[model samples]
Target: MTRVRHWPTLAVLAVALALPHFTRGTQTEFAIEVMITGMFALSLNILIGRLGLISFGHGLFLGVGAYLAGFMLRHLSENLFLLLAAALIVGMLVSALVGAMVLRLGGVGFVMITIAFCQLFYVLVLSTQTWSGGINGIPSIPRPKLWRGTDLPAWLSLDSEFTFYYVALVGLVLLVYGLKRLDASPLGSVFSGIRQNAARMRALGYPVRRFQLIGFVMAGSLAAVAGALHASLFGLVDPSLLFWTTSGEVILMVILGGVGVLYGPLVGAALFLALFHYLGTLTDHWRLVLGIVFVVVVLYAPNGLVPLVTNALGRWRGAKPSARGAAVALPEDAT
Candidate 1:
């Protein structure tokens, strides 16, 4: 029964793995972007959906990863593993430092502090034009090699669009799987407790702030990984990647897909990218149309499109919504 229940997720994974073969030209690139962005959204959702923390400056971590990767590739080696490791380490360290200060605040204060940090990084990057390329941005970053100083098969090279797509798809799958496991563990229970009732969790002797800090660091690290992938994909890093607006865009993706649902980020990223790509081609004022559609979705599907669709499917199949599993449900509110 458990295996049967996971068929949908497996099918989605299969489709993602096969996407590059079916897509051509810009569509292939767009699909890669979708996967990367989905990863970023998922990371952010860990804090927003599980911990009830809304960060308006998550893009700072993403930018950090991108710049770090770009700098390493430009000055050091093109080994993909090394780039990601460097990015992850730097991301965690930065997140730890920032989280220490920001996690002490709650609600709107937290949000504002995050945004402030993001903007500060943006300005710093711009000011350091010698390394960051200033307003023009760094460009022509070489694609990651399969392995540095090793003669590998050409197919394994990330320089190819098809190869990179699969690499990104695999990364996304791993991220989703790992996060799901985390969400089902005892630690996830504590995260939910904190989200639903911090007072109760504190009363129960849990280190609520510590948990929140850990979540923040984990999310930041993953976001950085996504950023490194993004930099590798585009061969560029820019201050805009660290801007507050970039974080806002990620937040929108999470909300549009359905916060707290395991697959929400994937659905949301696909939808958001599809709208931006297809609509922008048809009209100069695509933002207006996009905004209208977003408003409509939010007004109708308050919890998010993922939950709405899952509930509808559950009814059609003659199963209670709860039978779908904890992955689809919102974290329980403490009584």
Candidate 2:
């Protein structure tokens, strides 16, 4: 029964794993973008869906990761593991510092403060041209290379798009799995409780602020991972990465997909990017078209595409349960 219930997830995984083989050129590049965007959406959902924190500046962490990775690749080694580890460490520290100041505020105050912080980071990056490369942005960032000193097979090179796709795919899988475990744990339950009723949870003796801060840090770290992946994939890091608009796009992905659903972000990212890619080819006013589509979706499916599809499928299956039951009963009678 458990396996049956997971067929959709398994199917999605199979499709994602096989996507590169079916795609070539721009399609493969787009797939990598989708995966990275999905990672960002998923991380943002931790705050939006799990903790009810509507941040308007989550891109700050994403930028932090991208910049950190870019700086390391330029000055240090292009080790994938080290880049991710550094990104995670720096993301956590930054999130902790910012969260300590902002988590105390809720509602609009929180949103404003988050946006302020993101803008501050953007300004700082622009001002520090010596390190950040200013308005033009850092470019030509290299991809990871395996066995730098040792003689290895040429096919094992991570610089190839094919190899990098799988690396990003695996990283995303591990991230999703980790997040699933976290979401199912007691800490996740506490986050839910805090989201629903912080005062009540506090009355019950839960340290609400601490838990929220921890969640903030965790989400930030994951966002950093996504950012690092994005930077490596694009070989560029720009101030725009930290802009509030980027954060807005991530929020849009979460809401468009379905808040609180584990795989919703992936769905949202795919759909959003597909629309952006296809529509941009047709018109310069793609945003206008996308906005209209978003409005329609919001009106028709407030809960999100994933939940709507799930509910429809449930109803369709449930509608014929009596016949299924009778069929099972007939086999038992024959036995």
Q: TM per model?
A: 0.95, 0.93
lDDT at 69 for candidate 2? 81
Worst 10 residues of 1 by lDDT: 326-335
- The whole-model lDDT of each prediction reads 0.86, 0.84
Clashes of 2: 0
Residue pairs in clash, model 1:
none
lDDT of 1 at 236: 88
- Residue pairs that clash (backbone atoms under 3 angstroms), model 2: none
Q: lDDT by residue for model 1 over 279-323, one digit each (tens)?
A: 988988887887887898779887778888888888799988763
State the weakest 10-residue window (summed lDDT) of model 2.
326-335
What stretches of model 2 exceed 4 Å from their correct place? 150-152, 319-335
Residue range 53-156, candidate 2, lDDT tens digits = 88999999999999988888888987788888899999999999999999988888888999999999999999999999999788999876655644656546
* lDDT, residue 213, model 2: 92
